[model samples]
Target chain A: MSLSVAMPDRRVRATAAVVVAAVLVVLSVVFACAVGAVHIPPGDVIDGLLDRSDPVTRQIVWQIRFPRALVAALVGANLGIAGVLLQGITRNPLGDPHILGFSAGAGVAAVGLLRVAPEVPLALVPAAAFGGALASAALVYALAWRGGISPVRFALAGVAVAALFTALSTALIATSKLFTQAALAFLAGGLYQRGWEHVHQVWPYTLVGGLIALIVADSLNVLALGDDVARGLGMRVERTRALLAALAAVLTGAAVAVVGLVAFVGLVVPHIARLLVGSDQRVVLPLSALLGALLLVLSDSIARVVVAPGEIPVGIITAIVGAPVLLILIRTRT
Target chain B: MRSSARRTTAILGTAVAAFALLLTACGTDETAVPTATASAQGTATAAATQAAPVGVTVTDLMGRKVTVAKTPTKIVTTSPSALEMLYAAGGTAIARSSTAAAPGIDTSKMTDIGSAYQPNFEAILKLQPDLVVADASAQAPLAGQFEAQLKGVPVVFVGAVKYADVATSIRMLGLVTGTAEKAKTSADAIDATAKQVGDAVKGKTATKTLVVVAGRDGQLSAALNDSFIGDMVKIAGAQNIAAELKQSGQVPGYATISLETAFKDNPDVLLVIVPGNTPGPSISSIVARTFPNLNAVKNKRVHEISLDIFLQAPGPRAADGLKELTTFIQPDVKLGAAVVPGY
Candidate 1:
């Protein structure tokens, strides 16, 4: 529907939204770095950033908060871009990374590895999750395939696969007495205790996934026009959709690997981006990334300070904050 | 239809009158013996002195008055901690929750009654336990269900997350099981060890400490001052860095805090509780990488503690846990044998 807007007007609106979102992302990162379980003054935060503050403040800012906030920003970007790509590929408004059961698949494998073969280094957990996510994605693709993918059939298959994966994840967590508490923390999805190691783990995936989504943005837009029209336009419709789905799976897997299954950010951020700018995939993708980063950083900061000392999972905060914003945007836009 | 309605009304009136008569009789009995109901805090401990062979009335952790009629020979404990306390009180369960395993307690022949959070009530009933011990926090909800289905069986909820409560739970179990003397002995051992550890570290500079409990899935959570391990640290003359962090009630006495807060606190010692049979890089290793200059890392004070004694089964062995904590907190001081109890 937003595609009917004049191209020039849409461009201006997208540019504005992108600029605002980017600014908010930067501000939210700074805010996240400043506030935490411990109180550090704004000047101290700046001084800590420059390595001029006291030892404790310096450690809190540099070692703890800075790495955590960066991880949150990168994860938000990954989930946001993944949401945009999946929604584009499926041509379904409800499409997001979780719609394809990526998070649940990743959760099952990651949790299983952690419980069953805990001797494996913590660093390999993301790989395990990524593998699980891709496996489930393959299954969804196979089930959805009837010579070519129809959007509704694909979505239905995805839902069925997601339910099956979720049940498997629950069973794994339930049967293993050892894994219950920590596995639950992972399943609830949070950036709790994330550090420089997590930042190092996720950034490469975000870069690769974001680039892929951008390179194929034009194809996404053409595909959005309907498959028959896309084929007539000389596009390889099935190949493009498959590539986009695979790309989204990678992005979603990366995000889930670090923070478990954070809900709402991937589901709602793309819609917000489209409502703000227009239905342009090129604009919606980057803007959604920016908005996703902004929303998560802010939500993470709230997660830190609201209960002060005890942290709420970042995923919980995202759902509480994202659902309302998406609803308001939808109401005002309609 | 009118005659049937009249007969139903007559029956309902008879039942109401009988219920009122029963209530008056109970009220009169209570009024005649005002001292029959025990005091709130020391109800169980006080009841232990009474040599009532037929029955004993006491208050449980949930504040419900429970009457254990006849010595409870058959018992079921729904949590590991509850099972430990029961054993410390010189009582044993015919069946135990699957997760209930503790030091010095044998469960090889006991029937597995499933998880404490949702036990198999039918299996428990099949065992026909005279007493059912449940955890106050985790198994509190099952109390109503147990009462409804167990007929005359006494379901006692006893969850001890702190050092003081550990002894209280043991004594409560002892009084109910008619093993009060053995229970008092174990309870006294806990108090003696606490004092021993406290006195040994009294003059030393209080070590700043942080306790990180690694979950089976490798998630790290801080043990607050109110947690069983956290309370032990305090008693061992150390300042818990995460003590001030408010518990959000996800897990009683534990909180998930950002590693940043931990970094800022910069404790002198780090104690990581690792569950038994877990194999991997200790949480201390992860902490080491994140903050290499942490005092605990720099000074070589990061220690891995056993999850079984400190957390999973916080019972008679808590005294041993305290002694272990002191070795890390103030390694120089050695307590005399007075604190050690023969269990």
Candidate 2:
């Protein structure tokens, strides 16, 4: 837990970097709003936000696209923060939200809810998702906890559990004829007709998860050093790690609930941020948020216009971009 | 490590910021949707009638716009619907047809291109058709590739989803092939047959009917509401069970529903369409094994019809299929007189 010798200079530079990232996030949001299959001018996009003339344009901009863009940013930020926390606690560069079986757990629960209780409101999807995610995370943590949560053991257990749950989910979907198409679409992870309802549904979990990640930022910075070192430095390492795991679960669950499974953002963005702003959680966490938001928004925008009147899934674009970044990170780590 | 982290973050931030700026500049001058696009018009009409022997341009169902210098001299039709329309419009077909299972086309002089599920693309190219007409599903995936390869040749893809779309396709083919007068005459005859069937079944009580196209494995598949057979069912005044269970984005293909569910629904009439001589249990035997107590099978309301008439190809013979369906659904409706060959 020795402080880097250039602490003051590092702090100053991190602060400036964060300010720049914040500006980029704002610009990303505006950029997302301006472009879609139906082109609304930037002036009209701004005016639509301000509730000026042209009610149709205003409704399309604010009601349909704006909320979706906001949700993308929020989902991205949540995932980015969760990735940093998980990787820091596990001390594994390959640590991701999906590897922990959170998304599979959420998908299973969502499919079950749709099949058994079709009358349930769309808003309940995330709640069911979060519940399933927490239950699965707890199960994995318990099974992997022999003495301490070994990164390798935890990853192995998580992957195994994830595969099992995913198979169960697929079986359930295939069996029920009524939920087949919806289940397939959900599994594919496209944002075709998403609106304000999805945005309002997942925001609470995202906010809470993000806030908790920020509060435990310092503990994570210590935990990244190693469990014994963190504990010797007066940090409750096990408790801190557990809290971060719960926080990550909430973020991952909420995102999966809203958008099904968006792969690679969680793993790739955090590593990219860590490479840029150092391994310090304080800098890496916020930088991951900005970078994740920016990347997803750009990817979504490209997906929107790549085929006129047709859209490729955002997940496809993210994976195509994120996979190379992941390979580079693994090579660097080795 | 921190400085490296800062530099990576900086590169990502700059890249995103640059894209955002580019989007903002581009967004202002976005192209407007053209107001006068021909597709906007509901009726398929040219702005002005050109003189006789006008060069024809047709946008096929696969969204490929084909321009023919004149009416095609050598045509190869892979779709029975397209062939029926072409023959009914008096086109001189040079070579090739779909299958013996397909109704309406005179397959006596035509070479078979395998089955409807799989078309032999090489055989088709070897036919050297100046114009090729195929179903949309068969042509959609290969539309771009075919367009590139067959640059000089024209391929028209027809989607025979609705009965109205069939008529429209016939008209489009007529316009393109310089057989407008003959197309109109054939279209009128088909429309007349449909009207006669409609008049015959007008006062009959609506019967719940399940029309299934039997697959290779002897499993019954429900034809979609948007499919040609589904349209026939509706026109014949029969309530289709499969149509009732449909949801959006779900392609109406054969789904394996349990015998219990089928019996519980208890359709009054069951029409099974099976293709040429694939040995299996007859529809009656299959029904008896699956649902012995169902009213349709118990009362001998189940009937086996040729796969040709109902499910495989759609054209003038679709009217005949409707007539046959109406007769089966309502036994009192007599389709009297002679059985027409290519009606």
Candidate 3:
């Protein structure tokens, strides 16, 4: 049930995992559409998408449910891909957007700008977040680098920088009494009332960052073969590492800017993908995307429907699922 | 930021004239909530003669039997609004829930208990309050968490989600504290003012409104008619377009609404809730930039009210929110001065 590099049928397992993930994602989306504060049957949801449903029903399906589910998927996939890159480059299993301070940096800067200069167009806020994430990553990378960034050094620097940014964000939130609702949503990460506008705001980053990931993914595999071995094989280790780190930061910052900081996707999804398919970057990257998409879509659907109109934060669901799966992976991997 | 932001964000009206109303004797010492006294405490000395009883029994909003001293002089509230009501009902609080809520009181001198969600048991017990009031909307069934620590003190629950609930809570507490006449006097004043405002707006065509609490930075929670503020919205002759949305996880009467819904409704007015008197992020800008097509933003029908006049100022100044809401709905409606409970 688990995969390793030694497995003979790696390609077949990867293909099967991708297919299963894709099917689950589609099913999860349909399930999410069928259940919400306003219940629309799954068959009717499909009909509503085709414009064959009632006006109110059609609006809910198209305007609310579909956009929300898709945004969750994209955000999840973006984070998953980011996690794969970080884990590969850092060679640390715990490497992810949240642990690395990229998400925390994005949250603090974006929320700060939202409070201080809210006059800035909402669309532009993600750009600010992207900048903040890049800064934090560069800071961590610089702090960790003696001659070059080591895996242990990077992880430690990330933890310290993440703590600093998280504390800063918490302090900013405490300045006003009104941060209760919005801050709760931001802290726990949710899709409450998120719609097409959010999708529109986020997709461009996902597209560009995802393209960047695909371009450099081959380098990730070469980098995993040790720096000296990769150098002997004609790989520019540090340059590729820097490029992959930038791409990971961009992908995570974009998703977090729109949906707040949804935890566990980046840390947990890559492991599941690796367990499903042997750790080849080309297979692992795409597989991580699909697995991440499925995990979030299913968790998000459960989050919204279980409570209906009262949305439990999707982050809670993801962590609830991610934590157990993470423990299982940790226990089983050795 | 406005100069008002510096001069204490706490509204002074909540810490109103306790001594003024204290002299009045209305004999309201029955209980705080309706049917709670007789129901949950069905057997606890119910048959005892009504001649100068040492304690009055009443059921709280959580359906718990609470027996308070016939005259509780030392009172504490887990909610800022309840503390305000206690003051309005000719009673003084030995401790109050949160300092961030300035209910017309000089809160600097008062004993600060923690917030309703995380009350400081040590601070509360140190004050040795005879009667402790918690928010039914938020702190219901809370006694179980501190049953051992309460040490026989009565913790009453009061619902303050509606404008009517404000009057109801004051009357209930007044009965418990033997200040029924004063509580009645204050609650009636608010209701009378509200009725006057309602009567004025009743003639006018109702404006479709969306009451938004963006008190937390740049976040938005649509206020429904069933909400504490929404009751005032309807009473003030504004139609809560948000009221129709199904309830979400944001407390009792607030809902999560997409910008698309706002665009679809095209509400005639937008009432914005900002934190303190400090300048807040403008909703019009947020809406204009993000939801430019919204009618409220297009028509410049957005009104920003301090959180004090509306959300937190529940008890005596419930009418203040009513007046603010009515004026927000129909700008032509003239309002009399001195009716607003606090400045």
Which candidate number maximizes lDDT?
A: 1
Tell me the lDDT of candidate 1.
0.76
Chain A only: TM-score per candidate = 0.95, 0.90, 0.91
**TM-score between candidate 2 and the true structure:** 0.58
Estimate, for each residue in B57-162, the C-alpha lDDT of model 2 and write its tens digit.
8887666676666678888776666677667666756544445334444567775544433344334554567787776753454455454333346778775666
User: Per-residue lDDT tens digits of candidate 3, residues A93-134?
Assistant: 989999989888887877677656433555566677777787
Worst lDDT 10-window in candidate 2 chain A:
A174-183
- The regions of model 2 sitting more than 4 angstroms off are A1-3, A116-123, A177-179, A325-334, B1-255, B258-343
Which has the higher TM-score value, candidate number 1 or candidate number 3? 1
What tens digits encode model 3's per-residue C-alpha lDDT throughout B1-343? 2233212111111111121122011001211221243344444445442444677677765667777755887888777677777777777777777643554665666666665655645456546778888777555434554443454467787757778777777778777888888888887887788788877887788899988776444556787778778888888888889878865433557765555675577888988776554475476567768876677778888888767646665566667667777777888999887463441
Task: Give RMSD (Å) of candidate 3 vs. truth.
Answer: 23.2
Residue A163 lDDT in candidate 3: 97
Candidate chain B TM-scores, in order:
0.80, 0.74, 0.77
Full candidate order by lDDT, most accurate first: 1, 3, 2
Q: Is candidate 1 or candidate 2 better by TM-score?
A: 2
Instruction: Kindly report which residue stretches of model 3 are placed more than 4 angstroms away from their true locations once superposed.
Output: A1-8, A115-125, A177-180, A329-334, B1-317, B320-343
Q: Candidate 1 — which pairs collide?
A: none
